[model samples]
Target: MFITLATLTDVPELTALINASYRGESSKKGWTTEAHLIDGQRIDNEGLAEQMEDPNAVILKSMDDAGKITGCVYLQMRGDKLYLGMLTVSPLLQANGLGRLLLQAAEDYARSIDYHTITMTVISTRTELLSWYERRGYQKTGDVIPLIITEKFGILKQPVEMFRLEKTV
Candidate 1:
């Protein structure tokens, strides 16, 4: 597999990949499924397009030998830190090391830009995901915040919190 910087042109497929990876039964094919927690779309096309258009943000896409996008990581420079988001791996292709590759790319990008740390938020209840990050050198940081309340995020049937995780790069 190879990783490349994504452009606005990749938004449509990225959006579809993200939604399918997190919002429904299709997500169950992967270990990163959030289908049980969130009932709506993970992210919409417009929002993804905006992220791609942002001058300071870049989404790194992972593709297989045949050039299919299998995973992606959204990254942005915020002050002295790199903010990471939407780390999505194709549901059917999860656990094939795509996620780890994308994460290493994020760290390399952060180091290239001289960021002191990389920070991200994970659903507070995602123990496995959190542990995965922890094993990769991220620390809990003991910080938790309520997830943003926005219609586009989802309709909450239960309260949710996001835990902050940081890794010094």
Candidate 2:
């Protein structure tokens, strides 16, 4: 597998990959599924386009030998730190260490750009995911915030909260 900066042509596949990894029945095949927490598309082509428009942001994509995008992560320069989000791996391919590879790529990208820290938010109820980050050196800041319910993201089945986690890369 190889990792590289995503281009406009990658938007459609990225969108499908992200949604399949995070929402709906397909997502249930992976441990990262948020289908029980919310419903609807996780992200769309338009959203990916708008995010890519940010001059300070980039979406890194991982591809297999056939050049199919297998995983991706979004990173944006946020002042002195890098904000990381949308870390995704193909649902059927999870547990194959693709997530870890993408995560390491994110840190490498941050360091290359001279960023010292990386930050992200995780749903408070995702204990397993929080543990996964903690094992990789992320620390909770103890600041929990309510999740912003938006139609684009999906309708929350119940009230959800997110907590900040950061790591000095």
Local accuracy of candidate 2 as per-residue lDDT tens digits, 59-91: 999999999999999999999989999999999
Worst 10 residues of 2 by lDDT: 147-156
**What is every candidate's alpha-carbon RMSD to the true fold?**
1.1, 0.6
> Which residue ranges in model 2 land beyond 4 Å of their true spot?
none
- Report how far off residue 86 is in candidate 2 (Å): 0.3
Displacement of the residue 24 alpha carbon in candidate 2, Å:
0.3
**Which sections of candidate 1 miss by over 4 Å?**
none
Query: Per-model C-alpha lDDT, please?
Result: 0.88, 0.96
Global lDDT of model 2 = 0.96
The Cα error of candidate 1 at residue 95, in Å, is 1.4
lDDT of 1 at 144: 91
